[model samples]
Target: MSAADAELRQAFAQLQAQMVETQQRVSALEPQMAGLQRAQLHADATLQQLALAGAGGGGGGGGAENRAYQPVGRAFLLQPLPELKAAAADRRSNADAKLEALKTMKDYLERTLKNSENNLREMVQQRKEQASS
Candidate 1:
């Protein structure tokens, strides 16, 4: 085969390798994404339950002894709520970022594959013309 043919083959091989690798990564991420979605659903359910309990007087039912409870212990306990919110926000952001990145990578791989296939077809056409000549 000519140099052009050989180079075309090499390019296609590299593109195929990249497509395989990226697809594998995308596949691996899918399960994690599903799990995240499930976790988010669970968190929403828990938040709803907490809200209902708070409304129904099921929570904070400590009776007369709880009346003297001052601000000190409450402040310490309430401190973690902000941290928890921040953590959930961060996880959601990370999951969104990762999903976008995977989509971009998938798009790139598809484009590269298409280009490689077209180039290979053109190379074959050129080889045919050269042989005919």
Candidate 2:
């Protein structure tokens, strides 16, 4: 093959590798995004339940005594209910931010893949024309 053809082939291989890596990254992000969404839903439900319980006056203000147990590895730690709620809110916010970042990355990768495919096609066409000539 000519030097130009070899260079084009090398570039195509690199782009193919990058496309596979991007696909893997997107797959990894999918699960993380789903987990975050599930956590956010759980947090929202917990907050709603707390609100309802408080509005119903169920236990006079003993809700303050409510302790939330947080899991740490194989153990659990006792935290106040309000503090747990705050932590859950923070987790939800962080998950949302990460999800947004992943989405941006996915978009960029898709665009790059499209551009690379177009370039590869153009290079192949040029090579064919050169061979014919």
Candidate 3:
């Protein structure tokens, strides 16, 4: 093969490897994104429950005495209701941000894969024409 053909083949190989890696990354992100979405939904629900409880003054008439149990890793800790609500909101926001970032990465990988496929096809066509000539 000519040097140019060799170079094209090398580039095509690299693109194929990149495409495979990107697909793996996308596959990995799929489960993580689902988990994050579930966490966000849980947090939102917790926050809404807190809001409703607070609005109804249903904290056993002690108002600020309401407590909630929050999960920290594998353990649960007691925290004030307001603090728990704030933490849940923060968690939801963080999950939202991470989900967005993953989606963006997925989009970028897809576009790159498409472009690389087109480039490889063009290179192969050129190589075939050169061989025929």
Count residue pairs with overlapping backbones in model 1.
0
lDDT of each: 0.58, 0.76, 0.84
Residue 116's lDDT within candidate 2 is 70
What TM-score against the true fold does each predicted structure earn?
0.53, 0.75, 0.79
Tens-digit lDDT track for model 3 on 77-122? Answer: 9888889888888999999999999889889878887887787788
Off by over 4 Å in 3: 1-4, 57-63, 72-76
lDDT of 1 by residue, 1-133 (tens): 6887788678767756765775676577678667767766655654454444444543465322221211354462333333444455565666577667756776776676667567667767876798798
* Candidate with maximal lDDT: 3
Q: Which residue segments of model 2 deviate by more than 4 Å?
A: 61-80
Candidate 3 residue 29 Cα shift, in angstroms, is: 1.8
RMSD of each: 7.1, 2.8, 2.5
lDDT of 2 at 117: 77
Candidate 3's C-alpha lDDT?
A: 0.84
* Model 2 lDDT tens row, 11-125: 8788778777867777777888788788778878877765555455445566776766777899999877777778777877887888788778778877877787787788778
